[model samples]
Target chain A: MASGSARSCLEEAAALGSAPPVSYEESTMPPVDRSVVADLALFAGLGPAELDEVLREARSIRYPKDSAVFHQGAEADAFFVLLHGHLRVEKTTPQGQQIVVRYVSPGEIFGVAQALALKHYPATAVAAVDSIALCWPSAAWPRLTSKFPSLAANALQTVGSRLQDTQARVIEMSSEQVEQRVAHALLRLANQAGRKIETGVEIDFPISRQDVAEMTGTTLHTVSRILSAWEQRGLVEGGRQRIVLRDPHKLFALAEGRVPSERSGG
Target chain B: MASGSARSCLEEAAALGSAPPVSYEESTMPPVDRSVVADLALFAGLGPAELDEVLREARSIRYPKDSAVFHQGAEADAFFVLLHGHLRVEKTTPQGQQIVVRYVSPGEIFGVAQALALKHYPATAVAAVDSIALCWPSAAWPRLTSKFPSLAANALQTVGSRLQDTQARVIEMSSEQVEQRVAHALLRLANQAGRKIETGVEIDFPISRQDVAEMTGTTLHTVSRILSAWEQRGLVEGGRQRIVLRDPHKLFALAEGRVPSERSGG
Candidate 1:
């Protein structure tokens, strides 16, 4: 059943192709406040003048939900920092299957293929929600790095850790059972975007079971069934486009392939 | 049958744990030549004097095939650049399943956790073949970067590209069928380590079917069966710990889910 649903999901994804091209409109928006740039991890240690120089030619842009910020094969002209809302980094395979690679959180950088001197964006960046971002033209990368060397170092660190995380995800997909994979995927999402709710920690964005299925490389039916089972076991609470971890510790153990009895007794 | 074999492989990997602690024997090895550093992509633009400064405190070390260079979770005291032979970067999941993350080619840098200021190695590095490398103590990172700023920038670019590649692999694992995944994996390995042979391009290292299975998150039986079928089809030649792609174009088409008939007709 899981494989059948996964095939159908892939078919749907193939039909979807790419998200509709993003529509850009001129904005009367003021420049992003330097304070925000100073607070960003990328520019944390930059002096006031350094931050000013880095933002001198920067522009603020807004993208509506479900719109492409940039396409995978398009020229990489600018790099972005998410100021508000969410963005999804995705790659469409040669076979036309769309995969969610990762999500860009507030203050995080995206479209960094330019930083690596790549001519084209390796993946598409789509706005998961109505989003605002500070954009710097690719031409400014060298100047910014020269002035603030820490910026380059910080970016490397971010990229390194991200590589480690991606490899871990590959391991999970290859070695873990579907239930364990779902558990691990949820814990990761919670770490990235979880918010405290009255009952538990909620993923602070709209995400359907289909999205979870896509992220975990499983099927919507499988994810729905697992989440329903977890709900019955008092491990998680689920509703329309929302999931709250009622007991994160148990989920963590499950992700490690430990049964509840083994976890409790051991 | 495939799942059963995969389960047994996982059991064996769990028993293996981390590569037996890397036993470093004292050697009369000399410092790496400055010219070698000049040739590396990471140090491409460094002047001879700058290269010398970078290697001032470096040491050369050798590891026999299958020996550990560094274990996952161990303190990262140094960063390394492969001088000869290949290394495999692997990560063990919480469930004790080992996944081959990536292969390190000569002149490529590995064990870069220290460069990212990470306290422990995120993955284990094992010599896939008898290998030699230049190792630098982590304490010198700041001074080295301060002297040659390009070193840091170059490292960032390397890490960025690697992160993109890892994400691409994750997508393949998630969305591609096992046959497609295996084809893609073999193609990647060929590109990285291929050597012109009498009949075709051969992966220039000792890599078992079991290794390929681990790399693709499948089973030995599955990999063996696929290889045997490809062998019969004249697309590849498989032998003990060796594989030669007799027809790369067909394999490439298969990886993209194109049948030979469709590909030739189109």
Candidate 2:
């Protein structure tokens, strides 16, 4: 349903924008397909007419790899739904340290601070790879929610689940060791973006040791040392920017702070 | 509108329960006042009829200090709206470490895992003080949302803000030092639960140094040392189960990882 031509039009539009060197040619962009809209669980159970109404207001845009889709503190004029590729949401401290909050996968929504009545984006969203997203103006939300109550319901559910996940991450950071934290972070990422490979499950992204360190709240050297230890134990394979989880069960045991033998014996 | 007799009835009913030793008697409980429903921001836009509909299905109950309103992993049959006092949401790791996720102030909602369609509570909610809450069955959610869309919208907004706050906490834990983390944590608590005192603003709950240490992912010794250091500098005053922020500006500067003089100079 998503075409290269549509993406090209979006890129051209993004190019016209002064901020982020992106342009947005609204009139020249192609409308999102109804099938694509239907595929999103957020819009499930909506009638075809409602789906058409949504697509009428939707504009698909493409962002080049490593380019910011939106910056922190920018006005939340619109919200986005990822259609393809990955996005990393990050927040920067006053001292300029960037912290990766989480990654967005296809079919997930982001830039939704407006839905919460927030006037600005809470974090920056950057394209981890060349990515496509369907965007809707914040003003259109109330009408859309009234027309399709499921959209509001689904969005609420998504926000609720994310809150629980973030709280869990807080608990992990507060109580777990760095090694266990790294293991848990990898397991979560793998669950979200893993693809089966000859070795095991690859994360299917170009995530480096530094990125892992950021995610786990540890130093790069510590992440490198842990990965090296895991590689030696055949629990994971890492090279350059790629990581393959060779033994997820062992990693799970480590994340639970238990010896692999203890898990196996049990 | 919350009567002592109604609280007694609820307590008698809770006593009949097999789980937690808390008591409550539903039979003698007085119907919740519609005015009370109107007072909650979550139900702000609803008409009197809708408010009555909500009250018809609501039960107001009391929780004594240190009592658990619900346990982690318990069936999430109902969601609650705090009417008075405070509640602390906590999660226990597998290694038996309890992490304080967040605290719920009056007029806020908690035990809302059911709103996400989760079968069980993701965290335990305990009474940080003698608390009162109005509860509604999870099954009542759909009807409530459909009748009063603002309820769903408001709840979503609340969850969204909490998610952002939690992510901010994760960022702090990952990037800031323990001292900065402690300062930020106390400042946040002060914002939410601070009460004016003769010297400074006191956190309006009986929170211990151990609680602060758990919140900042540090040891009790570290928290004590930092608080003592701050006391010496006239930044904060601490006593048995109490903390009063003597110099919020200084704490704010510290939280930003800057000295007080630098902030004043800027």
TM-score of chain B of each: 0.86, 0.87
Tens digit of per-residue lDDT, candidate 1, span A9-79:
12223333453642232132334569877788888788888677777667767777777777788788778
For TM-score, the strongest prediction is 2
lDDT of 2 by residue, B1-266 (tens): 11123333223334444445433544434458877657788888888887887887777788888877877887887888989898888888888888888999999977778678699989888888898988877778888887778888898899998998999999999888888999999999999999998899999989988889888889899999999989998999989999999999878988988775224565
Model 2 agreement with the true structure over A1-266: per-residue lDDT tens digits: 11123333234334434345333544444477788768787888888887888878777888878877778897887888999999888888777888888999999988888889899999888888888898877777888887777889999988888887888889899988899999999999999999999889999778889888988899899999999988988999998999999999889988998774223475
Best by lDDT: 2
The digit string of per-residue lDDT tens for model 1 on B1-266 reads: 01111112122233334546522431322356787667789898888877876776677777778778777887888788899999988888776777888899998988888877699999888888888888777777777876777888888888888887888888888888888889999999999999988888899889989889889999989999999989999999999999999999899989987674224465
Model 2 C-alpha lDDT versus the unseen true structure: 0.83
